[model samples]
Target: MTNVSQLARPHLRSLLMHVPDGILDAPTSVGTAVVATIGVGLALRGARRELDDRTAPLAGLVALFVFASQMLKFPVAAGTSGHLLGGALAAVLIGPWTATLALAVVLLVQSLAFADGGVTALGTNVTLLGIVGVWVGWLVFVGVRALLPKRPASVVPAAAAGALVSVPAAALVFTALFAIGGQVPVPLDRLAAAMVGVHTLIGVGEAVITALAVSSIVAVRPDLVHGARRTLAQRPLTIREKVPA
Candidate 1:
């Protein structure tokens, strides 16, 4: 197990390096920056609400967990070992805004402190994994929830499907970014296809982890989950038994 883990790390880093430069455009960068800032603010505010009771500690734990998980890259096919893109799971377990903050912290730490990725490429990682991941995952979860029957059972599947799709969606975004400014010579079509294909398989792993995390939170503390809030009963109104006497 240790040998396998050790072998996979280099392959994962290589795949990340093959990614093209300047994929994160200025406009996209500004937008993600705004979203990420807002998310961090919201998380801090929410924590004050004794949402701290649930989401605060959980978010902290998840941020660290995600940061660590990304470090343990695993083999995908030949020279690529897939790493965790925790956007879907984080957003589903936390909220989109907060998930952004969580992932941002993870990415920042990975780049600055740990040097997992180059400092210059920080923007690319943030754009692909932080912004795209959260948006795609949150959108998928919301869409699936609307289509599926509202039940405890649906929660897992919704989270799972959302998680599964988000990885590929992010990969495509990265591919596009690469096409814009890739260093290594590779055709756009070939790059996009390879990225999307492998990441699709990788999504399964992401989805399973996300689903379990979501399911666990929903089962124990439904209020902490943004997606689950809809499934809950609204507060009843009782104004003097329907009207004033």
Candidate 2:
């Protein structure tokens, strides 16, 4: 078996999931920025319906957790690293609209404060991680939940499945954007293959973490888990009537 350390070659330690400033041409960057802006705008409006006194605190906690999780990186392949995208985790724990807004906030802070992603490439990161990641994971979670038995426990596996697919879906989107206006002249097929393959590995780790966290919360407070709410709500209420003694 290949040693894990051997895969950990030294590379620039910036956020792996985030696109840097110069990788994308100006037109591509600008176009993605417009799309990201529209997505965030929609999120801002939609989140109002998703957020209430009960969920408001959880949303803030989710954003904080995602921000911290993205900072911690692990070696994936030769000279490359990966970290939690947290889109599925957020979307499953909170609603998708609130999750989108939360991810946007995390990305913005990472870009501005930590410079983890580039200032110019902020929009691309938001589009990829915030919008695409959030929605795809949410949709997948919904689909998986529908297939499984309607129980609160089902949310754990469904959330994990969503987290697994979300990472690569975002990678594919990035590959498409890169194909359009990549600063470097790389073959599209090879780039897509590499990105999808590596991110799939990363997705496994994402799924595991998401499962653990979601299961823990579901065990303690299933009510707070947005994805599991329907399953939990569908639970039949039991009432006992005293018979004549």
Candidate 3:
């Protein structure tokens, strides 16, 4: 005979700390959805080009891994928890285009099936976590990799840096959305400070997890790791050069 709201109180409190339903105006939600749809459509086309026989199965496995990782949340601050966004991890394991599709699938499933994220806010979630997260992480990874030596060992640090930066970037995106159509009346500066601050700490955890995962894959199957593939390819060339005429 317990009250339903009382029963759901704990869950609701935890849920609200992350993006939830009824927080943004209808116009904002719809606009985010339109943009997300276009991004996903483009990602789908791009993913088709990226996924070969070798990468297609790997892409599916990365999606499954990211989905599972996201479920394991850790406390970041008072009454707030954070989990792996997994965009950087996915992009490092597969390619950025496929990573976007994989992350979008994970977000869609989480929203529709588990009700982990808001159904109406699925577009926002996908846009922030899937599209922006993947691209930002991928770009950072590429930039960092370029600065580092062309070695398999370098991929881990680059992926970690990408993961570290992408979390705050996503938080900033949310802050921008709130400025547009947030249901709450909190001041923009205060909200941005809170969101970005918490996410920066969360990004530390993201960087560690991303680094560990990328390092493990590079150690075991460097050739299969999309981010390390270029470095791995150079080994054969080096061996060929060592063979004198």
Which residue pairs in candidate 2 collide?
none
Give the per-residue lDDT of model 1 (tens digit) for 110-217: 677866654556656676677788779989988998788776557678888888998888778767655564544556676666667878877887887777777887
Rank candidates by lDDT, best first.
2, 3, 1
Error of 3 at 12 (Å): 14
- Encode model 3's per-residue lDDT on 48-114: one tens digit a residue: 8778888788999999999999878887777667788998899889989889889889988988898
Query: Candidate 2 — which residues are off by over 4 angstroms?
Result: 1-15, 241-245
**How does candidate 1 fare on TM-score?**
0.76
Candidate 2, residue 88: CA error in Å?
A: 0.6
RMSD of 3: 5.0
lDDT of each: 0.67, 0.85, 0.81
- Root mean square deviation (Cα) for candidate 1: 6.9
Model 1, C-alpha of 196: deviation from truth (Å): 0.8
Compute each candidate's TM-score over C-alphas. Answer: 0.76, 0.91, 0.89
* Residue-by-residue lDDT tens digits, candidate 2, 139-182: 99999999999899999999999999999999899888888988
Model 3, global lDDT: 0.81
Q: What is the lDDT of candidate 1?
A: 0.67
lDDT winner, 1 or 2: 2
Q: Is candidate 2 or candidate 3 better by lDDT?
A: 2
